[model samples]
Target: MSFGGEAAVIGSRRLFAIHLFTATGAALALLSVLAAWQGDWRATFVWLGIALIVDGIDGPIARRFKVRERLPKWDGAALDFVIDYATYVFIPALVIALGLHLSTLLGAVLGVIVAVTGALYFADTRMKQPDNSFRGFPAVWNMAAFVMFALMPSPAVITIVVIALAALTFLPVNFVHPVRVVRWRPLTLAMLAGWLVASSWFLLTEPPLSAGIKTLLIVTSLYLLCVSGVQQMLPRRPKAGF
Candidate 1:
């Protein structure tokens, strides 16, 4: 192919990556919906968690390599917002509604989820630059943690965890965007490799390894949250004039 053709193809591939991220998020949301239909809380959590991981990185990945330039025709920002809202807010509430058998308590919980997430989205839309520092527990993480607890098969535990997560949803807590473009190197590659390996193992295997996979997922989630917290606490360099 000619050089121009080759360039066009590479650009197309980059755009494809961004689209793939959103598509993966949607797929997970769909999976959660299905899980709820079958009353499989475990499956719902698993899919919801997977979506969280993907949604967390999508935007950063797009910006990291300048994927935006590749698709002048497509609005990456808008696509991201749509995916984020659907996956983190709508899907989780739907899953919970189904899992809880659509009782009055379920309706109440769903309302809270929607309210908290809507506030988050409103904040995000007004941001001049997407803050690497989150101002809240992060709608996605709250949903993931709740889903995990829901799968535990203990009504008491699920109720307690749900309540705790609900409170957290409104409390400010930064979550890492999951990509640090400035520091892309061996460390970044290795961490990404770890995530891929762990997530793939969890998704591919069954039963006997379920407990282990859940542990790994929790650790990863916490690690990402911690990293974001530390970054936020680090003192920023003052302006030269100051």
Candidate 2:
């Protein structure tokens, strides 16, 4: 096969793999929500943790399969935008609406966080053609933090933290793209595994409301740390050559 043909084949496999991983994440998210609805906190945490694992793995899985190599710029951009919206917009709102009724202050804080996070997400979406670095906080990390905080009690404290973190997202900080380093892959996997186990334990043993809240906090916090820490720990991947 010609070089271009070989690349296309590799990229196609990778793209399909990424789609599968994304689907898995979506499935787990649904399961988590279902678990929460049933007042099975452990199950909820387990599923959410699984979803987080899927999210962590999808990019590397895509890279390993070389799906990105064949994807058209527009299609890739669209996929990224969709993923961001699902995780940042739909998932957080769903989690909050389902799990806890927020006070007005808490709602306001979350609203600001959502708005700022959305702006950053859109900024990244718009600047896809030239391969520019993202300028502000990553929506995924903010959502991860917000979700975890919500899982815990104290809507007031969570709101404060969210407001503070929302401001930090837009602050001038060097945020690296995550998919650059292989070392972090193992760490992320380990954390995800731990989350799964811990969440399962809580679901099985603890009181429903308490168990769910605790597991949610633990999983969310770990996820946020991974999102923020990965940027610092991993080197950025070089721009893909078309």
Query: Highest lDDT: which candidate?
Result: 1
lDDT of 1 by residue, 89-158 (tens): 6666665545554466765665466546655644664322255444555565334545353334454555
1-242 in candidate 2: lDDT tens per residue?
99999987886665776676676666666776677678654456556556656666766666675555655442543554565555555555445444455775566557556655665656653422222233445555323443453356677766665565556566543332434334345555565556545545544564444655466557645563445444644566666221
Q: Which stretches of candidate 1 lie over 4 Å from their true place?
A: 1-17, 49-61, 100-103, 114-119, 125-131, 141-143, 150-172, 177-242
Instruction: Tell me each candidate's TM-score.
Output: 0.59, 0.57
Number of the predicted model whose TM-score against the real structure is largest: 1
Candidate 1, residue 140: CA error in Å?
1.5
Q: In candidate 1, which residue pairs get closer than 3 Å at backbone N, Cα or C atoms, i.e. clash?
A: none
RMSD (Cα, Å) for all candidates, in order, is 6.3, 7.8
Reference-based TM-score, model 1: 0.59
lDDT measured at residue 51 in model 2 versus the true structure, 0 to 100: 63
